[model samples]
Target chain A: MFKKVLVANRGEIAVRIIRACRDLGLKTAAVFSEADRQSLHAALADEGVCLAGFKPADTYLNMDKILRAARETGAQAIHPGYGYLAENEKFAARCREEGFVFIGPSPENIRLAGNKLMAREMAAAAGVPVIPGSARGVVSRDEALAIAAETGYPVMIKASAGGGGRGMRICSGPEELKEEFSIARAEAAAAFGNDTLYIERYLQNPRHIEFQILGDSSGRVVHLGDRECSVQRRYQKLLEEAPSPALDGVLREKMGAAALKVAQSMNYFNAGTVEFILDEKKNFYFMEINSRIQVEHPVTEMVTGIDLVKEQIRLSAGECLDYDFSSVPGRGWAIECRINAEDPENSFLPSPGTVERYRPPGGFGVRLDTHVYQGYSIPPYYDSLLAKLIAWGPDRKSAISVMSRALREFVIEPVKTTIPLHRRMLADKSFADGDYDTGFVRKFIPVDEDED
Target chain B: MAESPKRLEIRAPIAGVFYRRPSPEDPPYVEVGDTVKKKQVLCLLETMKVFQKIKSPADGKVVEIVARNEDPVADGGLLMVLETD
Candidate 1:
């Protein structure tokens, strides 16, 4: 085991990693920006280094500064908690070059998984079921027409370099495809400077489920189970739960095997997520792989009794797979709500301010991972997530009940939060009955009436 | 000469890191006592990778630069004071 580990991040996740390091009897070095001098993570670590800049580009995202901090702290390993450089292959390679173990997947794995089309190709080559669509970019209208014909109606044309819904169009039939194909190409050319386009069969209201897999350097991989992250606002997950209400035992086994296959094909190690989109009939398709510990990892941990962070460290140190997951069906049900500092009533606008009073929920099966305090001024320089409140119980019903009760108990004064929204979700019959899909949040929350 | 000339303050339009130059290796846009044309680019305010160019609101001589290079300035924070014509 490494004696010391340097965490190159801030906020709740950095604090979370520091706690995990401390639990493993490892001294921790925390790096913070000038704006985060009083951050909880820095104070909790054995040593701290200031990156001397408030912006992410000069601080968390600056590889040289982070590497310098690791050297200064005499740390043997660097653990990127998430975001920033967590999935940056270049940073991972740099850490290895600097003689520090990067507690994540190899640079090669990160690079391969970072490219969406390449990842989809890799998964398909591994015999994992990817969404039925063109294997590569459609070169001409005739090729697109043929692919769409085979893929059936309602196909989505996406730009190779597109994001934020730009350069994307959905065609319902042959005529629509013909009309929109040229326009999509023109839009892609204008937007991304590349007119390369691909087509995919669009799945309607699919549930966003992902499997958490941990692997060792010796090519051994095991999946912990699934997390239903269907409740999203603008593609950002707001809530997640373990052992999805949508999956049965048979389907779970199949999806779990597929997830392991994807990892095994790439020889992927460390903590990673194999995301999938499940249609209404429980038919699953590969979405993409997240090459880092995700925000909702706590839900999986609650049921599996595994500390993913510790496991990542051990695996990075070249430890063999220890636990047997052959028959290890996870225990109980767990749900997590991301408590962001945003106003749900006002279109979820960010509400960063000092927490005048802070009172957290307690009791069994309730856990909060946060770095916030009563007087900690919420910085506008970073994300608005203040905390993650998780609840666990023997069954899904009890989990929901516990979450509702916990939500009521939690309070943060003056600063607006999504607590009321969660409460309303819990009270809604469709949500309580798990009769909602990825579009649930969009429909559940009524549009702001004052918007022009 | 008895009455002191009124100085106009140039405040930041948004909260971000203030940069005096377009890039790290480039020279600063303007310095104290440099005469600046109306609507001339003076500096930049960067937020989340988006660079917003701060232009001179009026033709003036740069009297004082309140914000240092690479400093984090809040929205409406003072950046410079100008002796306008």
Candidate 2:
């Protein structure tokens, strides 16, 4: 076990890694920006270092500063908890080069799976189900139009680099495609410095399903079931659940095997998520792979009873496959609602403010991994996510019931939240029957102020 | 009691601290009665250590600043309401 590990991320993930390390009798070093000086993650770590000012690039993304902090703190390993540089191949390579282990997939795996375009080709070659699209970048308007016709009218023009809806444009026709294509290309370049674009036949009302796969250093891989993350806004997931109410036993084994195949194909190690888009017909297509620990990982942990962070640490420390695919039988159902600081009344606009009152739910099967406190002001520079409320039960119905109860109990006054949306979703008939698609949020829960 | 819409609220794009002037010694961009344009830099929102400038979205006269200098601003927190023509 490493004497000390440096957390290369912030917020709840950082706090999560620190706690996991403490459980394993390993000391933790937290790296924070100037804005996070008083954050709980920093306070809880055995030692914390200020990497730079508040911006992500200067602080969390600064390779030099992170390495310096790691060296300064004598941390032998670096754990990146999703987002930021979690899936950055360059950072992972740098960590390996600098003699500090990165507690995620190797740079090679990230380079292959992290690139949306590259991953699509790889998955196709592996005979994994993939959404029919162009084989390469769509450079011209004519080429895009031709591909659109063949792929069908509602083709999506997406920037081949970033995924969080910034570089994505949904085109129902040619005119919309022309206007959306250029804008998506420009935004993609600005967001990821990549100007390449691609075309994919957009599945109408697709369900976002992902598989959690883990591997050891000695080339052993296993899949930990699947998560339904269809509930989303702006392409980012807001709610997630395990043992998808949509997919059955046969589909689970099929998707799980496909996910493991992709990881093994890319030589992926540690923890990674293989995201797939399941159409309303139960036909799942490979979307992209997140080469890091995901935000909704708690739901999976609840179902499998697997300590993923600890496993990542162990794998990085040259541990072999301790358990194969059937090590842990994930029973029951788990649900998680990401409580973000966004107003459900104002079209879900980001709501940053000081919390005058903070009371989280406490009971059976309810867990909240958060940093914000009553009086702790929500910083305006970071993601609006404040915490995650996860619940586990013997079945999906019980999980939903527990979640609805916990949400009604959890409170953060003054600033508005997406709690109202979650509340509505839990009670919605479509959600209860698992008949809704990704458009569930935008369709039923109108984000507009007037509708509210 | 709402006053004659003289408020120019410079909302933060992300969550962070609110910095008044470019530097402590430098003069602040707008005083209580300074006339400003749409692109006039009013204040800086310091988030995650990134200093994002909050510009005037409308041409107006700076009426009053609601948030205190160096205080934190939420996503929709009103910075300074300006009275526009």
Candidate 3:
């Protein structure tokens, strides 16, 4: 275990990592932007270093500043949390070179998984069901068109360097493709500073499911379970549930096995997520792999009884997984709803303001993770997520019921939230019956309908 | 739905507890009847853990203080009332 750990990120995830470090008797340091000097994470950590300005490039994403902070604070390890430099292969390499432990997967594994194009090729080579499309970055329109014709219509163009719904576009035909390609390239360049794009067959109405894979320094890897992140808006996950309602015994085993293959192919270590898209007919195709602990990890933790953050730290320190892999199969069902500061009623616009009332959900089987309080100011310069509410039960129905009860008990005043939307979702028969898809939210929450 | 003076209320820029001064020992940023120029720091709004200095948007007199020091506020919630000349 590290004597001191530096969290190279901000917000709730940062808070989460720091708390775990504290529990393990390890001193923790937090790095923050000028805009987040008073954030909960900063207050909770043993110490905090201001990275730089409000923008990501100057602050949490500032590699040099983060490394300097770790060195100055005498931290033995750096936990990149989820975003910022979490999945950055170059940062991981730098940490290894500096002789500081980098929590999560190794740099070589990150090198293969950070770039979606490479990850896809690796998956294909591993005999995983990867989507058929471009073999590499499509530089020319002609190349994209060729790949599109070969893969069939409704192709998806994605950024090779980043994910989280920032740089992606879908085109149904050639005319639309030509019009969209430039915009997609521009968005990708602005967001990731790398306009490298790739093409893939766009599976319509697919269930966005991901397998949580855990690995140790001994090169042993195991799959926890699958999380269904199908409920989304603009590619941003709204809700995630583990032991995906769509997964049957046969399909679960197949997806879980394929996920382990992805990890083994890269010799992946620590915590990572291998995402897939399940088509309407239950056929699954490999999407990209997230090279860090995802926001939805709580759902997996709920059923598996594993503390992923602690596991990541332990594995990074050369410890083997302490349990029998075969005996640790996930049990029960878990669901997590992200309570963002954005208002669902207002087109999900970022709602940065003061939190007048802070009342989190409580009771059995309800877990609320947040770094906020009644007087906490919502910063405009970062992600809008305020907290996460996770619930677990013996079955999906019980989990939904528990989540509904938890959401009702939860209260954050003066700032509009998606709580009401969640309330509606839990009550809807389609959602309750697990018949909902990615389009379920949009179909249920129609903009033009008058709320009577 | 005709608007009223209450509708044009000034709000805090971010979410956090309202602070009257830069620090515990400092005087309050502004009080009712005080004249404020554009870009003048009105109060400190602390969010997450950052202390942000909320500045006046226009030259005006602080007519009413809707949110007190150390009180929690919502995004877009009225923080003060300003009367422009």
Candidate 4:
């Protein structure tokens, strides 16, 4: 086992990794930006290094500074706790070249998974179900039109390098396709510096379900079952739950096997998620792969009782998975609500300020993962995620009830938060019944101006 | 008597740690009573390991320094006061 590891990220995820490292008897080194001088992650780690600046480019994203800090601290490995350089192939390669273990999948796997088109191709090659559309980039309007005709109407024109709903257009017909092709091309060029666009048949109201897979360097892999992340706003998941209410035992097994195949195909190691879009008719299609430990990983951890961060570090250290996959059936249902510092009533604008009053919920079956406390100043330089509240119960209904109660009991004052919206969502009949989709939040959450 | 020289406040454009020199070993970029030209690099703001040059927006004499070396500053935080000629 490594004696020390550097956490090359910040916020709650950094704290999560540091705690896991400590549990495994390893010292942790944390890097912080100028804005995060008093951050909880810095305080918790055995050693903390300040990157000196507040901007992301100068702090968390500065590879040289992070590597230098790791060297200075004599850290044997670097755990990029999602976002930032977690999925950055270059950073991973650099860590290895610098003789520091990169606690994730091989850089090659990250490169393949980072490209949407290549990942789709790999899925198809692996015999996994993928959305039918262009096999490659559509360079001309005629090519796009032909692809659209074959895939049927209501196709999505997506940038080859696009994400977060940028550089994309949905065309319902030939006229719309002709009009949108140039616009998408231009947008893709501006956003990603590449005009490459691809076409796909857009599935309506698809539930975003993903499987958490863990693999070791020896090629042994296991699936931690599925997480239903359909509760989203503009593709950003607000809530995630394990043992998806949409899947039965048979369907769950099938999806789990498919997820395993996806990981096996790439010889992927460490923790990664295989995301799929499940349609209304129960047909599932490969969406993309997130080649890092995700923000919503706690829900899976809650149900599986597996510490994913610890597993990532162990796998990187050449340890084989000790548990049998067939015996590790996920117990109970778990739900996670990402409490962000955003004012839902004001179009969800980020509200960064001091948390004058902070009272987190507690009880059996409830867990709070956060890096904030009373008087902790929320900096405007990074993500607005304040905390993650996860609740587990014997069943989905009990889990929902516990989560609703926990949300009500939680209090973060002065700066506005998404607690109100989460409270309203938990009370909605559709959400309570587990019959909500990605668009459910937008349609159901009332934008009451008076609430602000 | 000529109108009192217009006093201007030099504020940080971004939130970060303010540094008085390019590196710790270097002398301070400018001291009080030093005359500076427009766009001259006055100090450095370090964040995320990147050092950004904080320049003088106008020709001025450094009247007072509100922020000391290695001070954490927020956006628009006062760094110094300058008297324009």
Ranking by TM-score: 2, 4, 1, 3
Of the candidates numbered 3 and 4, which has the greater DockQ value?
A: 3
User: How do all models score by TM-score?
Assistant: 0.83, 0.87, 0.82, 0.84
TM-score of chain A of each: 0.93, 0.96, 0.94, 0.97
Stretches of candidate 1 off by over 4 Å are A139-146, A158-197, A448-452, B1-85
Better of 1 and 2 by TM-score: 2
Give me the displacement of residue A178 in model 3, in angstroms: 3.3
Off by over 4 Å in 2: A447-452, B1-85
- lDDT for A388 in candidate 3 is 91
Candidate 3 accuracy as lDDT: 0.84
Candidate 3 residue A84 Cα shift, in angstroms, is 1.1
Output the worst ten-in-a-row residue range by lDDT, candidate 3 chain A: A443-452
Q: Each candidate's iRMS in angstroms? A: 4.5, 4.8, 6.1, 6.8
Model 3: per-residue lDDT, tens digit, A107-220? 888877878888998998999998888988899888888889999989989999766665778899988888888888887887777899999888787889999888998888
**lDDT of candidate 2 over A217-279, digit per residue (tens):** 778888888999999876778899997888988888898889988888887798989999898
lDDT of 4 at A230: 95
How well is each residue in A1-452 modelled by candidate 4, as lDDT tens digits?
Answer: 88999999999999999999999999999999977899999999999999988778789999999999999999999999888999899999999999999999899989888777888888889999998999998999999999999999999998877754566788999999999999899878877778889999988778999999899888988888899999987678999999899999889988888888888998888999999999999989988888999999999999888999999999999999877457788899999999998777765656667899999999989999999899998887688799999999999999989999999999999888988888888888988788878888887555644331
Candidate fnat values, all? 0.00, 0.54, 0.08, 0.00
Winner by DockQ:
2
Query: Any idea what lDDT model 2 has?
Result: 0.84
What local lDDT does model 3 show for residue A231? Answer: 92
Expressed as tens digits, the lDDT of each residue in A1-452 for candidate 1 is 89999999999999999999999999999999988998999899999999987778889999999999999999999999888999888999999999999999999888877666678889999999998999988879999999999999899898766532346688999999999999999878776667888889988778999999998988899999999999988677999999899998889989999999999999988999999999998889997888899999999999989889889988988888877556666899999999988778866766666789999998999999999988987766787788999999999999999999999999987888888888888778988898889889876676865342
Which is superior by DockQ, 2 or 4?
2
